[model samples]
Target: MKYLKTRFQWIRWAVHIGALLPLVVLIVDALSNHLTFNPIQAATQRTGDTAIILLGLSLACSPISTYLNWKDAVRLRRTLGLYTFIYAAIHLWLFVGADYGYQFNYIVPEFLQKYYLWVGLPAFIILLALAATSFRGAMRWLGKRWKRLHRLIYLGAILAMLHLALVIKGDALRLSGDAWKPLLAGIIIGTLLILRVPRLRRALLSLRHKPVAPAAVQLASPPAESTLVKN
Candidate 1:
């Protein structure tokens, strides 16, 4: 158990580093002009992509933990989810602020004009709701309802993938990099949903917490000689 604890501690730190790597790469790319001629598009794409990936990973935390029996993985879920929202906020800001020049009036007309905006909007709302209730105090206040509220994450994941699918170009079966991104994300979201079904959740949770068999201890068997034991 101690060994497991130590390993998870290291893994948690590693996850933290891994989660931040996207931001670091984005910064370097922006400064180096590696994002290409259209930095806004590249920035938005990269940020949006990272947000979706993080959101999916956060959503996967429970199923993965249950599947792999890594109970401690729950500790990282909140962190990953929060980062997911942060990236999402950045993604929205880039579009609303930088792309549209902060024209509040344009927000609605634009959503009406663009189908992808509608799909992304609901997912963003769900992300906001989850983020608002994510803290310890909110968890304590919400109690059992906390779990129910967080279940909205699955819906958010679906809508996010839908938004991606709507925005991406090229044939779904194409070998190009951008063509496959949404399909891969969709598959991940679908797997998570399957693992989240009630029957599967219970089965995985049961396996996750099931106790291991104890090692046999060597002892002499003197049952006949010690027959007076319980008499």
Candidate 2:
């Protein structure tokens, strides 16, 4: 592929594999019937985790390219974002169909009780809007509004993180394997936001430039401005 020749081709491919790996593992877990003791919970949890992480990665692509100057990164953002939506859709479907048995009567009561469910719905809705407009045609149609709309990803990420943190039955900060998941996810989301800061993005991108040694060496010190004015 011509696009493969772009700089950081290896990284793009690496990301592709990394994005899909979770799905592979999930599928394996499903086939082996080892997802969890509660199949519905397992499917919903795994899918939600996959979707959130993918969305985080999609959010990261811009900052990563801004820092690395890998133009190809822009191309991968849509792919990663679409994959995030796929996983999210499945997560929702499993929750509705398998977990609640398509019974909104039960889900509505749970939704009313759980704070996380309240927070997560908005994030999921934002994800829905983003995915709907992810295509090039939508990008063209929306123009400037597209950027503003897609920027909601940050808000979505924040809500998603809070949803997970609050949804945990026990202390998420506990010293355990599961405890680390939300913590690490928050760290990742925070770091990506930091990278997006204008000054920080410029500073990080500046590192890619090597000092122009020939320009420095070829130049001689100039006389003071006062000297030139006198002449």
Candidate 3:
């Protein structure tokens, strides 16, 4: 039992390190002047990308647990989710605080003009709510409502993908320019959501646990040996 506990702790620490590695790299790059000409834009894009990637990973935990029977993945979901929120918050700050100098007049006008911002803001808000209620106390206080509220993550992911697609320079429908990232994200997110379907999940579980049939034994060799011995 002690060994198992130690192993689990190691796994959690590994996940933490892996999740934070991007942020560490980002900071190092920024300090070293590695972020390109428009550092703010680069930072914002990186943070946003990391946030969505983490969110997708968090969403994957359930399917991983169900299909691969890796219950440890479920335990990592909250950690991944919180990291997603952290990255998202940083992305928001980079846009509003660093990029716009926290000027609402500029930010509000841009938010009104940009359709992507419309969706992105809501997605961020959803993540904010989720992050706020992710604590043990909130889980206990909300009871059944906690689960229902968390389900909004799926919606948030959808909106996030849309925001990403819309932010691309070229047409997303035509799969041009930077559309590939969001398109790929959409495919992965869609598959994950499909895996969550009750019927599909049950089918996958049944297939995973289905027993293999034993091979038929060949008895002809035994009879042949007996005949040769008798002769």
Q: Could you estimate the TM-score for every candidate? A: 0.82, 0.80, 0.87
lDDT of 2 by residue, 1-231 (tens): 245555466867787898788888888888899887887788888888898788888888787566654556677888888888888888888988877898989999999998988888898899899999988899999999999999898898899999888865567656454667788899998898878888886675554453545554347424452233222
Local lDDT at 205 for model 2: 51
Give the runs in model 1 whose Cα sits over 4 Å from its true position: 1-4, 173-177, 202-231
lDDT by residue (72-179, candidate 1, tens digit) is 878889999999998999889889997788997988788889888888989999999999999999999999999999989888998899899878876676646576
Model 3 steric clash pairs? none
Ranked by lDDT from best down, the candidates are 3, 1, 2
Best by TM-score: 3
Alpha carbon RMSD to native, model 2: 7.7
* Highest-lDDT candidate: 3
How would you encode candidate 3's per-residue C-alpha lDDT over 1-231 as one tens digit per residue? Answer: 346445988889988998999999999999999999999999999999999899899999999777765667789999999999999999999999999999998998899899999999999999999999999999999999999999999899999999988887777778788889998999999899889989988886665554534331234345654443332
Quality of model 1 by C-alpha lDDT: 0.84
Model 3 ranges with Cα > 4 A deviation:
1-6, 211-231
The 10-residue segment with the lowest total lDDT in model 2: 221-230
Measured with C-alpha atoms, the lDDT of residue 63 in candidate 2 is 76
C-alpha displacement of 10 in model 2, angstroms?
7.4
Candidate 2 or 1, higher TM-score: 1
Worst 10 residues of 1 by lDDT: 212-221
